[model samples]
Target: MARSSTNQNVHSADDSSLDAGGARALRRGLQLLDALLDAGPEGLRVVELCRACALERATVHRLLATLQASGYVATAGRFRYVPGPRLGRAAAAPGQPNMAVRLQPVLARVSAAFGDAAFAIVRDGPHSHCIAREVGTHPVQVLVIQVGTRQPLGVGAAGLALLSALPDAQVQQIVAANAPHLAAYGGMTAERLHLLVRATRERGWSVIGNHATRNVLAVGMAVRDARGEPVAAISLASTLARMPRERQQLVARTMREALAPLAV
Candidate 1:
């Protein structure tokens, strides 16, 4: 009876290991899909796919084969893999709402209220990426950021807003690692950066003037998740001439009030 119970325990452990391995494989497959989605029509070579997905060549090849068999991806010229027609069809299908869809109404309202371009951005590793944007109806508008553009995480309002929401230790680590790029921007010295971050944290927003583009100014506030960690940010950008001191303060007040409900 003792031997039988021991064997059963061993079998259960082996099954658990297999299940974990299968989960990891599924996760890798999803990572491959994400890489393809981000690469768009350009697709990716096997080597590039492997590197992006952090998988071995053989593993990526096998997963690609499986994805191809399922009509979710396709290969071209024996080296590149891209999302197949089925995937595109799925993307074009009606009734599915993505993050952009959910955030559109809020962005529209903010843009209408502020009379400036408003954007929603998500952090992507060391960069912050614009996910959605609504341009202001004004004739003279600021149009520096577009959807899918990546910006360094220590320079702009959106980046600073998101960085300010991180834990102190993590923020320090990221700032240290990105010191070189930060230095290029001229206001990224450790002392200045820490001060800005602290102020952002205290006020729950960040503002910048013409750092990324000439004649443009921006203000951003962090959007936190349920656990109160920053998950995203919303920013409004306008021409500096149109956004003089009083107007800037008014816009910032309006934005802060409008975005308060979105915080965790």
Candidate 2:
């Protein structure tokens, strides 16, 4: 009976300690940590972190200081904070496959079905970077784009496809700001770009006619995540001389079908 009473008293004391330590600021700090973990290598700024986690600047700063001192985070410059080596080690220890790694098989299937080069690209500011690509089984193909290559957001089929997926106001802003570069690609004027975006939205895909290479045609569609926001774009490029109108439509349809199950 005495031992049972002692154990109950200890449990009560532990609960009280936990309740005392669970302040609002501490809860906010944990939220910020979760956001950082989700962001991966692309760190967040103080303002963005605070906005995303709904914490005040002062509270976040204090939390960051504590986390940094404990070696969980590393801050650079005046704004950016990324997970430190300890966090990265923990993340990599499980040896679980990442999204890009799992996506390789799907990309291969798309390339096999279309018989044209297929690319998966993610947006990075004014440019989009090719994260993965599967080369087609063609004798002569556009071999310039490789993994990690960055292209202007309005230059190639992949870029235009992604741009078209964005909201009209956002597309217009990007096009207007990039007007000078648009002139290089004939008929890529802001008005023309807007028209193309409208057409892409209507068609549920985008196509560019020999803009990058003389006789190459490209068709692409944006892939969205669970939030209905575009995470990346997949595209197929082939020589216009080889791919007839029917074949082009088939390729577009096949690509869309392949991506349908993965769509949000």
Candidate 3:
């Protein structure tokens, strides 16, 4: 009887501790939600939210994921978080298209011009997700990543473009966070990613090969939002034969011309 009573007491204590932890998480989530709301439509970057909420990056990232999953927070552009549909502040109107739909025409134009696959990717925390893709009429195409595919940021041309556009400090933080998963994608390491970022920044574009797909080459350009912040990236991919050094530069310039008039 004594042992049974002790077990019951321990279980109750454990339950109580769990309840306290859950309550704390709830409070932190609410705090992050409030911060997103306060930032208005332009939204706040992770760094900005960290500064405003006085929270650690990992904590803020976890809370934001929960909030985003619940639809109370949404990504505004590349790295900004705004109030989501649950808050009724960012709901789309009737017949209004989202970012992917709005970008389809641009993707089509790029693919048509190059006879290769064009892709658009957006940053989601430490990862990049393909939100749109268009295939050209080429006889042989390199369709490496499809829509809805997610991979660590800096692993491919489009992802690297997105990574390169972020602040240097945030970039370092993200690279460290994604270090463990880097080996799965072509043995990528943090140091290699840092070098890639430097090269991309210096070249004003990104070109990566044999990272996301074997023997495939891609050229990527970051698309800016209205505020001149990177919101997404566009990449054109083909075989190495098709994307020689000169052709890579040509593709980059084509993407730049195509995106000259639009902002996410």
Clashing residue pairs in all predictions, respectively, total 0, 0, 0
Q: What is the C-alpha lDDT of each candidate?
A: 0.75, 0.72, 0.86
Model 2 per-residue lDDT tens digits across residues 1-264: 999999999999999888877776578767888988888545688898989988789978889888888767865323567675456446653666543564566678878876667877766544567878888776766654788887556567777788888776456556665667766764457677777778888988888776556677777788777778775787778777767878767877887778777633
Q: Candidates 1 and 2: which is better by lDDT?
A: 1
Highest lDDT: which candidate? 3
How close is every model to the real structure, measured as TM-score? 0.61, 0.62, 0.74
- Badly placed stretches (over 4 Å) of model 1 are 1-97, 186-190, 260-264
Residue pairs with clashing backbones, model 2? none
Off by over 4 Å in 2: 1-99
Residue 186 miss distance in model 2 (angstroms): 5.1
Candidate 3 on 6-35: residue-level lDDT in tens? 999999999999999999999888888888
Candidate 1: deviation at residue 24, Å?
A: 10
